[model samples]
Target: MSFSIIFFFVFFVSILFCFSNSDEVYVINTNGTKIIGRKFFTVFEDKPYAAFWKIPYAAPPVGKLRYKPPNPLRWLDKPVYNYSIPYNESCASGRTEDCLYLSIYTPIIKHIFDFPVVVWIHEDAHKHSPDFLIDEEVIVVTISLRTSIFGFLNTGDEFAGGNMGAKDILTALRWIRDNIGHFSGDINKVTVFGSESTAPIVASLLVSAAGEDLFQRVIIQGGSALSPADYRNYNFEIMNKLYWNLDGPFEKFNRTKLYELLSKSSTKKLLVASYDLFDSTEVRDNQRLINSFPLTVELSGKGAFMNKFPLEVYKRKITNNAVEVMIGYTNLDSLHKLDGFVRNRKLLKYLNYNFQYLLPFEGRRDEYGSKLYKKIRRKIMDFYFVNGTVGERSLRRFAKYMSDQVIYPILRQATLHSQVSCNNVYLYRFTYQGSFSLVWNTVLRNLNFSGATSGDEICYQFKCKSLSTAYNAEETSNERLFIKKMARLLGNFAKHGNPTPHSSDDILDGLQWLPLNPAKSVRLLNMGRELKMIKLPEAKRMEFWTQLRNEFFPDRRINDEL
Candidate 1:
């Protein structure tokens, strides 16, 4: 945690993180500003990458640093950082806090020194950008913080000293382990990846000791560590601020009346007192601010990123940190649609309107009761649509029972509790459906849909020229051998934490991918076309939703975080 030593300070270019890749010409100096990078490739593939745009590590949460956490990043004048200004344009009217900012890329190969860093924890908010696996020579970072109420609005007390969006991802990996060795990168081969809603902030920075060696390896796709809005404790920060004050205006904003009005307001008057509790369109609506916002529950001392709860810190830090894991999903990643349910799927008002949009806490479905929520939505539509009905003629078995009711009991309980606290865990189930899941509908004039949902493998690992403007040489050779077999299994699991590629053939003839054995019987794998690894594609419907969630909510909080 020490790096700020680029003190040979001179001046030529002032930003964009250093320059040139051909005939080498370099210069980097993190945090005190001054970087220069540029050199990209991949119209079809030529490798050579080296991006570096907008690299401030932190500082700039603004004015008395609202809700404070991230800090480092010394000076700043500002230059590149503009992934299309907060998701395609609209800055949602306020709160910006100069957006922390980070990006790095790197891949020019040849003598690859220390290389092996992967840091990309973005998600749907501000629509995650940084172009897929930066052509994987590995070093590819991408960051930014302050989402909803500037990082999950907490304040259960102590002038809000909690989870500042996982402390702006541990102060941007402590400025990439003291400035990623001037872009050759390799803080002991960091990995910390994420997908769909930042995979519970990378499984809350993998059961934090403030994310120990900064990272070792963990790749969660389609989320885990009980992701979908996990507040492990602080009793969900007083049930997310009284579930946003029972329709807000702080049904008496607790934490002892907003600790002197949030230490004397003005982060735009505490975000206009949380948008004046949604201008009382009958208070805190929009699915109660999308099921009461997300993330926040750090509090519990000394530079905390996560104090507990991710299966009690992955059962005491996964067998003493031998830490290496890879998780995945996407066999119809949560599918369900019914705009006129193909002209009435037994319209029990469209099967109770897509079974109240396939429940998963539709904001606490009025705490169950409409005759026990139609007898728990008819025991989950007769345990998945057969004699219990759902017919636009069983829409592909209702999109595989609404995509295994949102990805098989939280990725089969985070791969059976990280393979019984880490002995090794790897799992996949993408099952291809590319061409960006079938695009091309010149404004609904034709083909606009298919499979591949929940974060469509980020359009086959980068290069989504709007999914396809042309791809007919065997679909451009199966999209360049599926983005070089997903960058040789995420750059051979960021240089050998194991995704197999022993001296690479760029996969397909060197296939291995094993390691998830809930007691045998496996065979399968892929998103490019053909790859198999069996036994898990709804293993008897994820064991009937894990024995119906251990016979209904057996002490839920995702069964106390699995």
Candidate 2:
């Protein structure tokens, strides 16, 4: 045979061997439900790993169950679940009532039986596999919960108490606690990790009474339940618009009638009405620093996820006091939000005229035209603008002004956790700008931005095929080095409850990353061109906000009491 023919024969034999070597894996939960899964190779190293995808842990929240807490699944017939294939995409990309499924990936190497588990909760949790992290000899899980109005609509009573999204997450956690061990995962070493928009969920789980003892560690980045944007009352005007769009008598309907109409509406109609309420220029005008679909204080009951606000939960020590926490934020978390101002000069003018919008929602709750409201708004304008107006010239300052709203809440939560929790609180600032800067390149088109944006760190933490096109070439030395560092940092935390714990590794370069000492000062490791421990970045601005909150919005209460 010729040389080409010989090569083809060898390749064909290798393919056959690869297929023959693969095996199907199955696990039986404590409840006696057999779940069938498949084994796959990692993206980079091609090492074998097991994946169980799209396994339902809760009953579908459809029909009468809409807007209610998730119900634990019942295997009435003792069925065998053959979830050998993955879903088409992340559930966040679609609108559905039956989206409460979770996927698990575990290292299947010989002699590795019980690995640390990292439960990932993100809006785009399923867009990419955790192949890279799996290569680090850890088990990874990605979970999906309801989103948009379907997950948060409330009439403020037992029928529709809201926070169904949060309750879904809580149910998923219970499932992991009971079922993860059969898949070679250590339930005690579970670390609940969330990034960007999902950070609030992780933080909320940290403080909720229902979340106690479910997980031992947490990693939250770029969000906090304390952020005004994440936790607030539903916009009543938007609720009214939704009712009107649904063709229901707006305010005249009783709570029971409202619940009946919402639970019975079609998913398409609900989505259209939700979009109608959201797709408008005055969204910011009406909502004013509030998240469009915000997490609410659920009514107290057997299944209440968050009966009290997170601050009160922390104050009263109704939280997991021994759970170690790794929390931080990017330098320019809100940079992409500025893309609108860059395109619309009209918005800049509106911003200047409506300076009160710059204030936190807590400040906005103060009556308009009140003395404190004016003082707070004027103080923010003067501090950020420095005698200038909101325009192209002040874009950088405005980015800081916008990003601070996100960062302050994270810092506040870190401080509170450090003070009250018996375990250590490790905080860091992710400032590394890699080639795949999601916000810098995709959203802003690489407009001379230098810092990392909110979700930029995710590309380094995982091998995402969707983001591969962002790279102009193969991974640069810096990108590889950064990825290794991130894996080591997080993997160390999951296994040993410390990132640098002695730091004999070459990647960390003997960096001893210390935890927060809020009693003295808040120090953080700045992950950047040079990794060094530094005093909090933007100290002056942080102090300004701390003083402002102390003076104007001193206390946070649920129903005006803890």
Candidate 3:
């Protein structure tokens, strides 16, 4: 062959070799379908492991199934494989019907030894899309489900049942039990974990009959059952009114008409209308209006759902010894108090002004306003560390109130309940301020007040690739240590159904995890590495929560005393 031809041949072969090595292939289980996934490597136990991303576990929940429970697909037919980029559609924001899908991440090649499964439910206050739960190690699965109206609409009729979102979770669990073994996962060693709003739902499941036996381990971070009182006051009457108002009459408000109207409306409009009766402010602001309803209302709604059909299968409590539960909150979880309207002065003033007149307790409006302001400020400090911003003064007060009424009480209850219910229950308070940069950001001039707010912790827990990008250098180092601690605890729990080795010292410290025993629950405050377990002054914790509950939700029956 000519020298030029030989040179071209060698170059072509070299390019092919590089391209082939760069790509990773995945094989479908049935009928030999195959596709190439992006190849990435991560260091695991000093060994490199390959990972594949975005494997689907359920058919898209678009169109007719939009507001309904998830129906996972079976791979019974020939594997229909295409290398086309997998579905990464952003979750339906307002009233989207196209938000059904699940993603899977696993080691490229499964070994004979089965690995534990860690399924994460992403937290967007349960509003955002499902792409947030992408982790490379231990098989990670996340599914998109209906949020807002489609998920939790309470028509207050036998036909309008709540828990469509929860039913989605059940479907995902059943899928795991039936198919995860094929991925070299032990069906029995599944752990479910999430933060914020997701945490509360998971906790509810732990206590509810519907959630029994769905997973062997559960972790709740930063959220509890102490939701707002307004959420529960869902006016099913409003749904009927809006349905008729939009469709023009009852004859047109049938399922077909309802679906047609829903299909035509924007996701935002649907959410606003769905929650208009519960809180007009939420509708005006386009926030999660229904979610802002009273916690008492939510508990009652859940109870009603449970009463309608006893989850017979889930009620058979298979030994309280069967599952391991870990519940915790951040050292400064009150930071979330600043998440919404507090950031906007106009909105705050508007809400304060409106409430001053519309609310029956007009005289106490200033007190409520002050309380909300304090919570915002404290949340700013706890999450971002920098205060002294434009809204700092108001936010500080809001943060304080939130800490006293929401964060502390919720953590205390979880700790107490777990301790009393299961010997294996473990509780923790993440006091580590993470990296110094993160701490510095809390104080950095213009930049300091700009970033690092509540919900920032999520940046580190999942999808973070570098400590530098994740947090400040010094703070990143601290965060690394903290992550290590968290991962160790999680891994240990998955392995033995206990958070740490069965040692007396560990057990003692574990036991000291602030009890929820209404009379003696302690709130563990972690400062740096030091831990201080302080008993919540009995009068403050119980009395305050009781008063708050009664004042906020007089018509509803709620277990807020805890």
Candidate 4:
């Protein structure tokens, strides 16, 4: 052969060798069958893994299952073989009830090494699709469950119960525990991680007696157990009333008739109805049912809905000593609520109108409410992006409210009840504000901000395209190091029940990660590029908690003096 021909042949062989080395295989679960997943790299050398898109976790909660608890699938004798595409029907254009399938990613292991398992619960106000979190490295798994009407329609009558989605999650976790080992995962070292709305769902598992043993460690990012205000007294009767208003009047609706109506409704109708209701003040309050204490007997009748009360569950199962917990929130989680506003001027006005009507007291009406809303949104954007507050008053107030109502209380209760070591209950507040050009350009529509906001951390840990879009030179380096740190933190927590070795030196320092204290309000984990701890004044923390208790639970106060 000529020298030129030989050189060309050598170059072709080198390229082929590189391509072969880059390919990775994943094994996923479809019903009771298994299928192979092949992942390849894109032109930018970005990793892309495509498995069957959407799969069902339970039988479609349609027909007889509508408004009732989720029922597991019954196996058939047909030999199951294909895992090439997702098994469930597509989520309507935006959201769907047909989303009941789970995706599994099993990494290739050359040796006999047992890898820890991480199960991710995707976040979308419990209404959107779950395509943003399919990764290849850590055996990423996600499931689609009933949302809105199908998941949480609380009709006091026996026909419709709340928490269908949570029950779906439990079923999925049980599936993982029983079968994940076959995919090279350790059944005992499973860690459940969720972002945004899904975080509370994982917190429910941590506190629920029914779900306590499903996994060993819990990681909640961005969201918490706090419920929306309107749905605090959620019950089947209330749900029936709400449904009747949306669909028709109650006289026209019977339990069986309603179920049939819902069954026939396309998944798109269900999704639209759910989003519509979410926009309503009444529905928002009802959604908050999980956050309050002394849940009415009506709410607890639904088995998994009771899991929403983490404080109550912690009190009852205080001594159940079997799990580890890690909790964190992004600096500008509130910005997630404002992204639509930033992207669309029409949406901003629409949101302002909705929120103004939602607020209980109406002394100042539009002027005060609109101003407050604008200030709050701006503060959220600034803090999350620039890490510099134009003014401290708004952020301080918001932080105080969040801490008093949800974050601080949960941490205090968990610390008080936990029999495990201090390290077992890890807490963090992500403040690493920077910019990801690609992520901003693509997924976020070029909204420039950074430092682990909302579900951003998931992008780092999982090999998903959502995070890849945000890659710039600075972010690329940060992403690689952050991924290693996060994965190690999670893996270590799963292996040994603690986030890290408990020695003083080993504990994260200079980051202001002090122990949680309800009284002094000292523990606030600032997880920015340089972590710091900010101690809320004792008087301020107590005052905020007192105000929240008065507003939400006048009958049960936390003794102002105490």
Task: Quote each prediction's TM-score.
Answer: 0.33, 0.88, 0.67, 0.68
- Worst 10-residue lDDT window for candidate 2 reads 553-562
By TM-score, the best candidate is: 2
lDDT of 3 by residue, 455-492 (tens): 45554455444332343344345455544444545566
Instruction: Report the lDDT of model 2 for residue 536.
Output: 88
- For 1-562, candidate 2 gives per-residue lDDT tens digits of 9975686567444434545543554343445555556777775567778888887889988887787789988532444465666675544665567888999888887766689999988878776778768867889998888877867766566666778888788899899998788788898899999888778888887788788888989999889888776776534665667677776544553545555567788887777777745543454443246566778776555677777777778778777778899999999888887788756545665667766544433543655567866676788888888584776577778889889888888888888888888999999998888675656667867466678778888877876668754433565656776777788889888888998886578878898999988667778989887788999877788788777766776664422110
Clashes of each: 14, 0, 40, 33
Per-residue lDDT tens digits for candidate 4, residues 1-562, read 9975686567445434544552444444555554444454431224454443343456776667776776776433222333444343332224545567776654454563365667777743223212222222345566666555666665555665566667778888887777666566777777888776566666665556667677877877755443333123454444465467547764755667665656677766655545543334443343232321112223444364463344444344443356677777654444444444445535433332333222211012224335654554443334322343323223333333333334444444344434333335666766554443223334455554443335555444454544444444554766555444555455556566555554452324312234444344345556556545564323354443445445444533122221
Error of 4 at 295 (Å): 11
Best by lDDT: 2
Candidate 2 vs candidate 4, TM-score winner: 2
Error of 3 at 487 (Å): 1.6
Error (Å) of candidate 4 at residue 165 is: 0.5
CA shift at 530, candidate 3, in angstroms? Answer: 5.2
